[model samples]
Target: MLSRKNLEILVAAQKRLYCTFPELPSFEQRWDFETDGVIQALLTRLGDNDPYFHPRYAGHMSGYVCDVAVMSYFLAMQFNPNNHSYDGGRATTKMEVECLDSMARMLDWNHYQGHLTSGGTIGNLEALWIHREMGANTVICSKGAHFTHKRAANILDLKYLEVDVTKDGSLCSIALSGLLAALEATDVPVVVCTLGTTLNGAIDPLDEIFSLKAEHDFKVHVDAAYGGYFYLIRARLAGRNRKAFDFLPAADSIVIDPHKHGLQGFGCGALLLRGVSESTSQAIYTHDSPYTYFDRRGISIGEKTLECSRPGAAAAALWATMQCLPLEEEGEFSRVLLSCHTAAVKMSELLFAVDDVRLIVREPALDIVVFYIECADISAATRQLYEQLKASGFYVAMADCDISSETGVFREVSCIRLTLMKKEHLAMVDELADQIIRLSKCIADEYRSQYQAL
Candidate 1:
């Protein structure tokens, strides 16, 4: 449900907006407008869509974006500025710069250069394209990495190689070392490390991957689209995960999605580069485009990105959200993520007591909880649990995982994936776990009855 108080505030602010500009022209935006009926129909159609803001929808690597982002995005679109050129988005471009710097500080970079992209996919594409431009031939990534790296490699026509992951779902440095050692010495491969994988919230060891750089020459690019904001709560995480985030500043390039955990709406992500200098970037951006980049008003962010004509509204939304919830350790936003981690922890503990449940990692490295039904027909039971949960209005996801760890943990089963990403979901986890057990019991009983009759 939309907040009435915020809507009133937005209306009040909108009234004040007209005072700033000369009132030369105005148009009616009431129900009488020609598109109003169509908009009403669209709203009705949207009711069938899944409600992601609700706590029940813990299906995937997404969460409830904050209200401030909605308000800021709506407010900025009134001007409809384009962030491609300097004069085209004088105000928003600076806001985007500030937003980039804020994210840089979160990553512990005192000085850096970056620009916002449409989302993580394009953000990663630009990084790979830059590597290709720098004479890098092949792309090496873990099996757990996002599919975008391989797809981007195909789009750019570069050779792609996949490495093995540890049983804990992290990129195996040993496998990567062997791959790098065997590669032709003349070729420099771009190694893509993941901070948080989409399948399971597994964090690759960033610190260990960089260690291999000296032994074998390769540029390191981090795919933190799902987990970059976890940097804010680095102290909350421990062991391999915490150590991995600490080494983010050492990465050559990083990709993050503000649309996800950053609490902005969709279509907002960023690409941060460490080694690309100002003069070098200028040489890269200065192409033969006559009329587009002629404006000397300020720095145009489009030069830093592969995408053209980016929405300034996304930048405005991010800038405003940062003001409301600054990306800092031990801050309110970090506490939200901490609550999610705690929720996952609680779910893990509760699942242990359930009759037919096996946690994939015992404890989640992040907020994603994975468990399979330990039954004779495990696959069927897992699918039934997923469908019944959705029907019960407690939407969760399913993952087909084949896991093998260094600790001698091995499982090849269809599993349930619970992404308790909302702060509110923390409170309901106990009940959520109860529902899983109750539903699992029914599934097990039904399977038993069928087997006995047969």
Candidate 2:
């Protein structure tokens, strides 16, 4: 049984968070939309309207709470398994193994193998390390790929090749092929394909890149952290055209975040290597232990995992959430996520109507809809708009896109991105939309008046 004091701490933590919520709502709100929506409705009825966005802070997608995630977090704490060694936590490790298998199967890789990591960055580094060990000297990724890819290359001390992404933020296959040919001439190795880019949610052309791999001898790794799970949700909705869903399992290794789309709390992610074998032994550096060895499989998790002393509580939470909500078509969680995609499209449509702001990418590939303030040399004007909206309680940030000039890379573009989630929040979309339109018009008018006077 759990200790009374520990239980009290949990309760106290909840109360404190609730008390401080309005003042400091972290990207992740503990209360579900339904719970908060009811209070919001009541307040609106009473004419005590208040906007929910926190100024100066962007919300993290991993912070959101579903009922299953909350239950998983607590239940895992109860078991308190230490997934380091077999003796310490056999059952918990087995649970993680099953989860890994499910992740592989979901990606359609029957012979795939993977383990949980703290998050996508760790998973990415681990995958890159394995590929580096397998004779990859040069790593190629989209210019818009997460900074972690370059950081991972730095960690390994390898030469990183960044392919200029197309205007939509996806790597062009021809450009990549030319680079690969140039690298091959120089005897370079390895290509890391991006499944979904972080900034604009663009999916790299996997089929074309894989075709290049078939002709050449370079290992491929896919960073599917943000968009991999979309396959399952999109497949169920789109049915026959599931060809796009099949790209995940094709890479030599892949990174998928259970925290991002799995609806679990943060710090729980997985890195999967296709066809893992004894050659890929995870290093062991520990004092002799009775329960360390496993006879069936030569590789224990510690061999492959980057972390040695991680929280099994995260694994237990994920396991419990999986039990409560399966990833099938009929599951409620997938449906909710599908609804989030719908909400994104809805938001995009509304944003389109506002003048002087155009979508960076015409159509969204996932939940992220990116748009920029399309005015010239007007950082001051845009900054003013951002300040006004933030002061009015609408939280958003000026997104940056690196543009290459003769001088080098510069952050010359400014945009606002909306990551839509929760069906209940969709109901408030129009209200938010109206505010954006109103603010944009006001700012444009101010800009025009000032320009004319000057």
Candidate 3:
């Protein structure tokens, strides 16, 4: 199920794009060998991949690209613009600026300097690199934050520290305050706040974290790669979540991935710096390109980005998608996000009602629901249930969680994680929940039988 309308539009748009350069003499270059059998083999090989486009594939953060974005990307691929410099892709460079502006506006940023990257990992790396250039030695983040933060710190050769997270998998504000209070005299260069965690989709208390900046001299960088688009649906979010979105603009820098919730394909992540001057970026990232930057005297994207040869098609697709969807609270895009969150909430309710299941979080903060099978050996039962579900045509993911017990000790637990990213998932929530409950019981019974036999 792909959209036929998008296919037609892409073909028509590609023809128009070709017609734009009529002045150039056209020459036909044809391949000498026959390619029909090889092409069929390639298609057969690609079909072996998982069905991530289907609504039943709620396993991970992989999302289906919108039809408009797909069409726009295909149309731009006819030109294959490289966004390293204006000379490489003049029209797409302007599109990248407009796309970055739209993202900044969504975060309530008035004045900012930003550009798109290949993905969140590189975007976060650039944010930390900027902090390192500003003479900061320590990088701090929640334990639940993406693992890239620590790796990025290592790459930057800076000291790294992790704050504890609460039972809900969110960074504990009290623990963070304690850590900062102890390091009151130290220079903690960057404090990375994760807006949406990888495992449970937990959002740290950004407002409280930013409040600590009053006493500490650290720059706050928000990793909103997965949850940044949730800002557009603030009207439907819980109070705490809404408050977190409200504090987004206070960050010194932020990373948001257009490929995630922005309904675009992969290789689109953005880094936004608030009130950063051109001189500072020039000092850090500026490099002399002998042949590329000759066309423009002003700052090219190549001078500001950590990467040199980014895809201009990514920018074209994002700009076209934003033009059609628009980042507004009452827009169709916001409603789609709301539906994803609603599906998670509904799934959580269904899990709560089942005696054999236990939710990792009281409720889903975003569109991810995580729960474990209740059994004598929870880890085994959960794994068994995960495999059973997969075998039964329902693809879901698994995560290892740290659970706090009544004795003030932490235990490792394996949990089944479901990300309701597709809008069509809203209709499958009830059936999915019922399937989980039934499979969990079967797994639990099988485990009990084996224990008795032992």
Candidate 3, which segments miss by more than 4 Å at Cα? 184-186, 297-299, 404-411, 452-454
**Clashes per candidate (backbone, < 3 Å):** 2, 2, 0
Over 1-454, each residue of candidate 1 has an lDDT whose tens digit, in order, gives: 3479888988988887776666566653666458878999999999997788888889976677687888888888988989998878988999999999999888778878789998999999999988888778899999989899999999998899999998778999999999999998667799999998987789999989988888888899999998888888877886788999988889999999988888877799999998877787777666756768677878888876788899999999999989988887878989988998889888989998876677777778789988877666776788999999988889898888874332244456678999988889899998888899899888878877888988
> What local lDDT score does residue 444 receive in model 1, on the 0 to 100 scale?
75
| Per-residue C-alpha lDDT of model 2 across residues 113-134, encoded as one tens digit per residue | 6788999999998888877776
Best by TM-score: 3
Tell me the TM-score of each prediction against the true structure.
0.94, 0.79, 0.95
Query: Worst 10-residue stretch by lDDT in candidate 3?
Result: 403-412
For candidate 3, lDDT tens digit of each residue in 1-454? 4488768777787778767778998745599878899999999998997788889899889899888888878778768888888888887889999999988888777889999999999999999999889777888899999999999999999889889998778889889888877774556568899988999899998988878778777788999999988988866878887888889988999999988988888899999998578788779886777877877744468878889999989998999989998888888989999999999999999889887778889789999999887666777777888888888889999888876533233467788999999999999999888899998878878777887999
Candidates sorted by lDDT, descending order?
3, 1, 2
Error of 1 at 276 (Å): 1.1
- Where model 2 places Cα greater than 4 Å from the true spot, the runs are 1-63, 185-188, 235-244, 282-300, 402-411
